[model samples]
Target chain A: MRALPLIPLLLGGWLALPAHAADPADARIATLFNRLAQAEREQDFQGTFVYERNGIFSTHRIWHRVQDGKVIERLLQLDGLPQEVLRVDGKTQCVSGTLVAGVGNTPDSSGRLLDPLKLMSWYDIKTVGETRVAGREVDIVSLKPRDQHRYAFELHLDKDTGLPLKSLLINDKGQLLERFQFTGLNTQAVPTEQELKPSDNCKAVAQVPPQAAEALASWRSDWVPPGFELVKSYVRKDPQTKATVSSLMYDDGLARFSVFLESLDGESVTDTRAQLGPTVAVSRHLTTPKGDMMVTVVGEIPIGTAERIALSMRAQDVQTKQ
Target chain B: MSREALQESLSAVMDNEADELELRRVLSAVDDSETRATWSRYQVARAAMHKELLLPQLDIAAAVSAALADEAAPVKASRGPWRSLGRLAVAASVTVAVLAGVRLYNQDEISGVQLAAQQSAQQGVAVPQVQGPAVLAGYSESSEQATGPMANGVLQGQAGWDNQRLPGYLRQHAQEAALKGTESALPYARAASLENR
Candidate 1:
């Protein structure tokens, strides 16, 4: 009789497995981004868009196309300097001036992809509204951080395709810090062969192993304001000085910060603090038992958090004592 | 401070109803770390009790105090030929924007570069070559200072090294914001604006 009674419970769970109520849409969104990342690596498209921060703005041109599942993208800095980037599957193939030198090959402080699973723990996600961006209707998803440790985000996903049409970064004060939007988008027609090729100015680059670039481990955040996670971390040599710079990045799904630690070349340096709009940077001088070190923390966090993080950084090697 | 008294003070502080004595007590213990922790704890408890997003860790008092101190220190120096200069009254790109605003803005924050580079960034940023330097520089300063009347923020003269590095630190700050997770445009705009200037 007990076995018979438990049969419905097991059946109910078996039936419920496919449609998890907590984040069915979130999984779809993740799948959509993975597809977009793949498409960006392989597809062909070209468009003009304006990039604006604060009040200053500039126009940019990007041509991306894929062949036999292989992707190639060329982004040109239209204004100011004649900078450009030609990449095959998100990894750079060539450059004009500087392309953040060693990007995919180097350990950089830049955070990684948005994992909705981890993010759901920090941010409450919901499909709140709808709008149009880049001439396509988009569903609005707001990722409001569960804690004040990070800022909030509003994303507009293409309704038809599930791709991100627009994204907005906002602080606790409800002020917009940045916006990334596709003013015009098209997946209906693939880009032509000629459009996918880089200009003569696009200098050829040699591919290097990203792992060979740095052999560093993760830099853990000392006191993350809860719900934050270790998103990405890397070490890259300065393109100019050729010195190694260790970098670690953390994210609360919405807000983020980067810590860069570079060895001083016997040069005297002072501490600094700066804020540009919503972002804050805090540098503190620390004298380890080994030698002197400077910790530079840049993020959109409380100034005190930045300071504390800077102070708490311990040299990863056992040879150096905190 | 008594838990009840502290909670009352916190409530007063939240409602902007604290008397001078209560405000002084809070300010005096602001650096204790534990006291500030307590304040935030109280705030979180109250916010949870009321179901609000209360970020007690944000040291608004320190930021406000520092900003006020920075704005006032320049004036307290009183009189000099540079002091009487009215260029600060208007928003001249170089002396008014980068110099005046950078000192205070950077005093609140930091960079990942070498110590010398960090110091240089804090003290000696240059704009002669950027082409659109003045236009973009002015725009960034104005956007950040939109909330109130900008006084010496971009004016009120500081020394040479200080003037130069502030813009660099400011730019570094913007670039750092641009590299994180998601595809937000605000950080892109900030990085673009810094380059524009």
Candidate 2:
């Protein structure tokens, strides 16, 4: 009798194998993400959104336009300060606020594209459920990290246009770190020239020539979380402090962080770690042969991962000797 | 199995004054729906009395039990009596190292909390008063200058190495991420949020 039952069980297991192997849900989620990427580039819409995190709440209006295969976007804070930013094809053109010294001077480089297929290796992308946002029917997609190195994302995409209507960043403990939700959206009307025009208060970003490459090649990280790749690296000198800071940006397709290396030059600086809403900053003091160096890691990643990355930064020559 | 006895045992468990027998009695009754409801009610009442934020859905006890069940047992290496003293010495050194590490970590945490307290206190004093709608914009702008060092919402204004460099580091990171990121306006919003007073 046991043998007789075993035969059907084996046959049933064989029949279920193919269905489990080819999961349609994964394929559908991948398609939705691909559509989301395309929608960002092709869709032109005007919307107002509220960005909220711990101790800070602000509302903003965005005007995104696609003209001749270029993406031009403008954002203005609806609340205090009336802060405005204008971008032409993802490169910031100007801003109303004071720019950080020694920033926005990098040579123009292509923007990082969202690749759902590549991101799947690090995050488990799945459609959790459906919801309505900004008076539009939407699908709720959750991107959960496979490892504890990064935070998870919950995205609500419009069913018709696939544009993200709401995005929430959640930490490992399931607490929401930050939220971006649209209060109103108009997809039918293309943003006009008058709406796209930045106000006179917006100052043009000054461009400086790229610095020499040798400074960037001097430092390297001994270990980073698996799947994170070095996406960009640059060195800039602070005009005020005159400190030469070299920054290396890393991303695992979905989440990103940057490692900034600056020499302390015998200055007494304590190592510090801080969390600003969804972003975490970790600094470690390193005593090198030449002098002391401070390695600071900042990004939308977990605090432990940032600290580990900060600790793992090593000079290029030290690795060669090993 | 009397209801009154079970209630007493539940209260004992809640107060953490339960003996082995009382704990066992409460654990046995926990499977019943009525007992579970009573337990949760007691939890809410206790939290209210203590003025604690009660997360009703979080059953830390059950989670801890599950974690303990799934934890692997430690494997022991074969040893002789001669090596026992050496093993003891190694263990002692490991304990010393761990204690030293914890002391260092605690110091770092205490300093971090003190810095945050100082920063918030300064921000409280620096917050500009709201006069009118017309001056609101100008007031916020002036407040930004008054709180420029701590305006980024992370650093303390203490004349130190971090106050001078961290804001620039933070802004550079944000701007670079905004320029390179293709996830639409999210990055731009983040960079912009940093600028908000």
Best by TM-score: 2
Q: Interface RMSD, all models, one decimal each?
A: 9.5, 6.6
**Steric overlap count per candidate:** 37, 0
Lowest lDDT 10-residue stretch of candidate 2 chain A = A1-10
Which sections of candidate 2 miss by over 4 Å? A1-22, A105-108, A208-212, B1-159
The candidates' DockQ values read: 0.07, 0.16
Worst 10 residues of 2 chain B by lDDT: B128-137
Q: Candidate 2 clashing pairs?
A: none
lDDT of 2 at A284: 85
Q: How far in Å is the alpha carbon of B183 misplaced in model 2?
A: 1.9
Report the lDDT of model 2 for residue A30.
69
- Each model's lDDT comes to 0.55, 0.74
Q: Pick by lDDT: which candidate is best?
A: 2
